[model samples]
Target: MTWLRALREIVRSGLTIERTRLEPLVALRAAAGVAIVIGLALWLVSPAYAASSALGAFSAGAATFQRSWRPRKVIALAAGAGLALSTFLGYLAAGHLVTFLLLLATWSFVAGMAWAVGPTAGIVSAATVAGMLVIITLPTSVGQALEHAAVIALGGVVQATLILLFPIRRWGAHRDALADALAAVADYARRLSHDPTAPFDAKPMMTARSAAAVTPSQARRRPAALHGPRGLAERIRPAVAALADPRVGAPAEGPGRDRAREVLGAAADVLDAAARSIRRGTPAQVPSGAMETLRIDEGDEVLEGPARQAAVRLASLLGEVLETADSCDTHVVPAPARGAADAPPLLRPTMFRLVPVVLRAMRRELHRDSPVLRHAVRLATVACLGYALGTALPLGHGYWAPIASVMVMRPDFHQTYARAVARFTGTLVGVALATGVVQLAHPDAYLSGGLAVVSAALSYLLMRTGYVASQSFTAAYVVFLLGMGGEAWDQTVRDRVLLTLVGGALAVVAYVVFPAWETPRLLDRLADWLAANGRYAAAVVRGYGDPAGQRRADVRQALLASRDANAAWGEAFGRAKQEPVRHRGLTRREAEDAQEAVQSLGQAAMLLETHLPERGARPVPEAARFAEALEADTAQAAREVRARRNPDWDRVEEALDAWEGADSGMDPVVRRGAELQLQALEELATAVDRTPLERDVASSRQERHARAEEEEESRRERDTGPAPPPKEEG
Candidate 1:
């Protein structure tokens, strides 16, 4: 990408508004928490102290609204504590410029690294950096600083207390995650009737699993409905895929295909009903009518072989789903159990015990190539340099400079650049609004406080709508906050605007110096996804060859690993597309094609998973050898892919040919399925090896050939009148 194009993209992305449903009530509630803190502080101390308290309360409440799985109150409390601590430390060091800058650098770096934990943690920590810069300057003495810090902590306390008193949809995120998982499966089932090769989205399931990881305290209060259905959905995916697949379960046409379609539709209905029940925390009564299709009648044509087994399994699981998705207040239903040898349960430690866990996660990102590590280095450098430059310039707005840098810079290239552009735009608008208010109406203290609250409320409501909107309100809130404290905002707004531009410039330039572009990581991510997909596919295929020795738990773990790798590659690919770096080895078209190939590889494995034979059933004689070869070949292919070399699947072909030459003894069904797996592997190899030049040449030749054929057909039509329409494929 050229610099001009990149700049245009950054500006466009920065200004793009997201269309999210407005939740006025939630925003109002959080605003009320800020208002309460402000009102109390004004009644007791003064507006200056009230501004500090409001900053703390508003920041805490904002953090709670971020994408966190924990209870909102817990997030509020954690944010408050972090803000209080940073506030206290920042003030203590503020007495010396050298000391404060060093501390600021360290704090900013830690805040950047916090992203390794999650977005919620990372964002809350960034808020702390802002609080340290903006909120700490109010205190004059050490004693006053301590008092102000306590007030900031109190602000968080008020927000948490308000949330506890009037909660809005408790465990709402968790419910949505689980409901979405079930809904995705339902949608997949529906599509399978018409498109047998429909691929399942792993994102919803991944989200549900993340939501299921609960601290002991959370586990105690978690609803019964959220516990059991996720596991069932995971198990049902393979069964449904198998039943719809022509090679494995049902015939391509005839009575069996019709039965498969009917079973799929019925499964979709039941899953949808269960989803609604779980989401609403209602009784599972909605499935009563739709559940009958799951029952095998005396004359039903669909009840036979693997299709019959899958239908029966689906019915049994739906029964479990109905049994679990209800308003059961008796005892919380236990989460599904796995074999002792399976992966550990999704248990989270108490928040107090999360320090080590977070540290370990951060530690893992300490490597040179880690984006989180590079972001930390970039953040620290920009923050410190921005502060020095801001202080040295005519506009000595310490908070404005560093806060702009801290808020705009993200771990990814696109966001960092986009946010820097957005930050400047938002700052200008916000500062202009503040300046207008000052010039037009010099509101009294109470009115200024009210205006600040209103501004904050607007920010909360629009946080997810766009970076520009929320950031504008946030900037205006700070101005109004200072205005409430008897500050001369007319001149201050101009200074802040200048410093904001400087800060944004610093952030953008810093990224270029300490770059962490996703382009370089794409190959690594692709290799990882390829290897993981191989292992997962191999595991599923091996189960058919060695059913007695197969561990379902191992297969399940492999599937999870593959999904994780797929997600990682997807994230990198998305970021890489937006980045302005040179393409590394693989072009954009090749990357996309390779992704599709890997997806097909996983989809084929999913189909195989649906038909693993019982232990006593006969296994294909050469299946084990073929599966072993596939595993080794794909692993090697992954290594080659990382080096930008075409993968050789000669070993895989040899194994398949050997199986084919000797498969006179194997069942035709299993034999055909193995061939399907081989075909998917070959497609993956072709996808990875084909160059853009080759594809373009091939397409051009095909288009010319097609035109010549069309001319010949037209000539025939002129000579023989309109030819009969070609018959459609059966």
Candidate 2:
């Protein structure tokens, strides 16, 4: 039954598709690029050379489709260089079978380790492997090897040129990312307006943050042109999140709540409109009268004071974002602000100094406990085993087995197993379809090449839909691609299916024997999140005292660190939940409570940061003392979480009581923010103190019965009179 349940889950997950709005455009561009390059190569070059060149071009182009023009160029150059080197080495080693096998194994191991570097490196490494396999199979001398490598490099160059020619999509991607961020903000605002206590899911906001982060990497090369929209999105995220905080935006009853709801709704409408405008590359226009509600008279007090201020601030921020979106659409880079001489000089690093910094960062990952290191070793081992098995048996196209194994294995067991299943199933179905098409149509080289282009296009179209669908198209594409290279269709299909099965089996076995299970590390990851949030909260509270903006950078850095740590824990927890029952260290309910606690702490910290005025006004002495006490309490809670011990609830409650008493003479806004922070902290403490297991059933029942009887006795006393109570006391 357990196995049956697992199988059902795997199937359901594999079949679930996620559709994005821009996928069609991305797929169209990718298909056009690959098809045009392959067509030109076939027409201008020899048939065999064209096939090899087209493969390299298509692989590099596919790997870098989503990157900006600058990164695309960089990737193209890297891919070309890698392909040339692999092809030359493979050609040189082909004469000696023992040497060739050894070289292949070594290359596979190194390529497998490339996953440790990052996603871009992993893609480039895979492309190199594919190039080597293709080159080694062709009967070629040393001279021919150089020629083939040159042609392959030329293919990558062509793809890069095409990207430069068609750079419009880069801006489109940026717009879509910003729009996603704004839309997420709008959703959060709507939820908060309806109910302050409504459950807030940080996943959407986190996703937007990640998208905003990606834009900056590309902007480094063309800052003036690309940075404005990305920066606007980044600036707007915190403000929008702050507005959703119950503390910052809490309204009074009746007219106050009504006005608050109207203002929030209007802000959401404006944000959504701005997002739509950016997505469509049009001028942003707010709805008629939307901004009117945000304007507050000096004497007007219909909306609760702090909530009204928050709404006004949110409206102003939304206007700024819309203005930026308009500028982006018009391609007008905003001029740098006047009086720039008054600002501090930006600290720029020289390339020579930067190299060592990068090396140090990479070196930090070279440790026994690093997941990347462990996964790299596992991948390399599986690759070698897969290769050996393919060679030992009389399997045709033995490299496919190793390639499949390398592709299927990931850092975690859930992904590895899922990919293996998807790969095998998709390959089987794809081969059957391709076999039928070939037998019926008998496509010539040019026709087969076209079919391959169509298949590749469909693969990109459905890439985010599901692994099964994407891999199915990918398999069909490979079959057609090989046919263009003059392989027999029936034999190719059989070899592909058999080798994929063998490779997937090897991958599964490797993970079963030596798994990097996420379960055991879940506690540590959660603890890291707690500690990082604690530091973030403390830094934000301390910033209220720094009038010179001395701690502003520190606050931003701490927030980023906390976000990263939380994301890491979320990923680990997600993987842990997917594991077998016995393997999961914490139950789902326990994990949820832990995550909620961390999120509440983070929200409270963000609320403090947002409400803290610029040109910092001195907080009242009592408020200062309360801030210190809260900071201490947060630190203690972090330690308790790390140690897996119940936090001191009494101490936390005492601190809260002290903070409540210390609110005297504080600014009304400061008092409100402090009160909200105290409540959030209390919630965090409660969540942290909850044991994984519930109280004993018998004890709970007895306690409930006793409480009910006490309530009944009190009700009877109130109804009868106070005389009986007095007599009993005497």
Candidate 3:
């Protein structure tokens, strides 16, 4: 009876352990990896070890943690997880050196598969996983590789557990950064509107429009409950963006930084108001002193430097918005359609949309004359040299070829140079650390094995830090492996130093010779993006008369296109910072152009809708003349914009002249149409001045909505459905 009771207790414990130990997929990977290591260790081909497999598993788990923390589409997260887990399992099951190599290749293939399906998230995972796998599987052995595999799997499991259970506070930090940015934009807007001394030209308009453009979507996706202060920061990205208009230029009082903060603060206020409107289903009408709201009293306030400037700038922007709202003589436009038919033809196709063009343009600027490409070429050349030396030295392991390639190829020249220097320096330090551990401990299988675990831990810590940390760990692991193989310290040190110089030299050569130009490519890409957006905006106008179904389709496509373009521009700008002198102004002009186009399209859509009932109102020749003059000015604006990336002063003057002339001599109907067109042109000009795409898109949507509503009203009146009397136009 006692034995039976003990057995029952044991069974219950086992069941609980099985349920709580690991996720089913993860458990299966651990089990499978262990099985392969056991098989290979038994085979014992020479002094085979299991560190590589251990590293692989650890890396995969680390990737899983990275993915789970980000906001991703459901399919992306699932596919990314499956691919990473499967790679771990594959590495574990591969029993021979060739099998291990195949496993590494398979891991990359799987990660790529996920990337192919998921876009940004998938590609990032694939690159990291592939890079790590190649580093671990250098010698590629089936026999005696299980131990390495197990260590790697254990490291991975621990990392995954820690991230899932503890959750890092970094995401919160990012959120805060974004919030700070928003406050600055809002403050700037307030200043723009209220400051009597400030310029009332397109500069203020651009700043105000950009702020409004940036506030909406950013207010939607952030999760404040999870991130707290940091989340609040992220939620203000749009608000921060509002402060980025180029016309704001340098602030007069102190440094430009303070102005930026003021602008951001005003943007934040607007966002707060906008968010309230969204939540409560009530719109915040534009205020009269919106322009004055942005006025910065240089004499007042406790804040100094960039913070004060940013606050003032935001205040000005808010003032501007209020004024614009109060002065609006026409109706606000409705949202654009969310369908392809309602959007531009270029956007109808999901692939090769507007964004790529923008990206490509940015790329062209830097890459066309890129120092980075020269550096890459130099590095590739040096890698070939190392390969020759490694083989000639009779070490005959072509393994260093890829190592040299990986270590030297910087994403940019500065990074490449730093990494090369760091890799060589860290290699010396790592080899020394390994020698000290081996000498003091006189390593046994257990002691050497313990060192392996330590190496995994070090790798895990270094994993998120940066390239230097990763390289440091790689060197440490290599030194440990050398010790495990019973190599003499002196000989190991000599070989390591030699390879370090070889790798470093090779990398420099590649970097110098195979430069990857990033800027010019990005500019051309941005141009292409603008062209595509132009087409999409056009389609949206054409479909404005269609039912809600068509409008919905167009709006979605346009929104997606705009988003893609925005994201591409963000990345391109990040790349641009590396070569600001070369590519700084390339996209700035195009962005401005797109903004104007969006405004024009929006106003046109609204006017057409207003006249839908009056399409039968007949062409009043006087009104037609006014409309024609307005159209001519728009055409001239477009041509001038297309010819010059910056504001074409002559063309702008001509356009304003035409607009003023047309405004003076027109029938009421023509006058209204002319005014709408002029308003759109001004808004478009404002967008160009700001250089942010979001403002242009928002303005365009506003136009589309106005047009849609007008058309619907006309149809309803004609159809005579029960309806209220038309409200007086502003």
- Using TM-score as the measure, which candidate wins? 1
Candidate 1: minimum summed lDDT over ten consecutive residues — where? 335-344
lDDT by residue for model 3 (1-730), tens:
2435533433333223222322434323333333343234324632234434434443444354232323212222233344345444544643455555455444433332332223333434443443343334434553323344344444444444444544433333333333333344344345543441221112222222222221223224323221121112222332233233222222333334354544444455664453333222344443444334456675754344333443554344343333322222222322221210122112111222524643453355344354433432343344335544665674433445435444455545444555566666566666777778777877754455446545645544444344344455556665665454444455666666676667666665655555554555554444444433433433333332232324434543553454455455555555554442364444556454554454344334323322222223233333333433443444455454445443222332344344333323322322333344445554555555434575565466557547754775686577677664322211
Candidate 3 segments whose C-alpha is farther than 4 A from its true place: 1-50, 61-158, 161-389, 395-398, 407-414, 436-470, 481-491, 529-730
Superposed Cα deviation of residue 693, candidate 3 (Å): 31
Q: Which residue runs does candidate 2 get wrong by more than 4 Å?
A: 1-29, 36-46, 66-70, 94-106, 109-113, 199-248, 336-361, 545-550, 581-585, 621-639, 649-664, 668-730
The sequence of per-residue lDDT tens digits that candidate 2 reaches over residues 26-109 is: 577667766876687678765576577767776766666534323565567667778878878988987787777677767765
Query: For every model shown, what is its TM-score relative to the native structure?
Result: 0.90, 0.84, 0.47
Better candidate by TM-score, 2 or 3:
2
Two-way TM-score contest, 1 vs 2, winner? 1
Global lDDT of model 3: 0.42
In model 1, which runs have C-alpha deviations exceeding 4 angstroms? 1-20, 285-289, 302-304, 327-331, 334-345, 619-621, 663-670, 690-730
TM-score of 2: 0.84
Q: How accurate locally is residue 191 in candidate 2, as Cα lDDT from 0 to 100? A: 81
- What lDDT would each prediction earn against the true structure? 0.81, 0.66, 0.42
Best by lDDT: 1
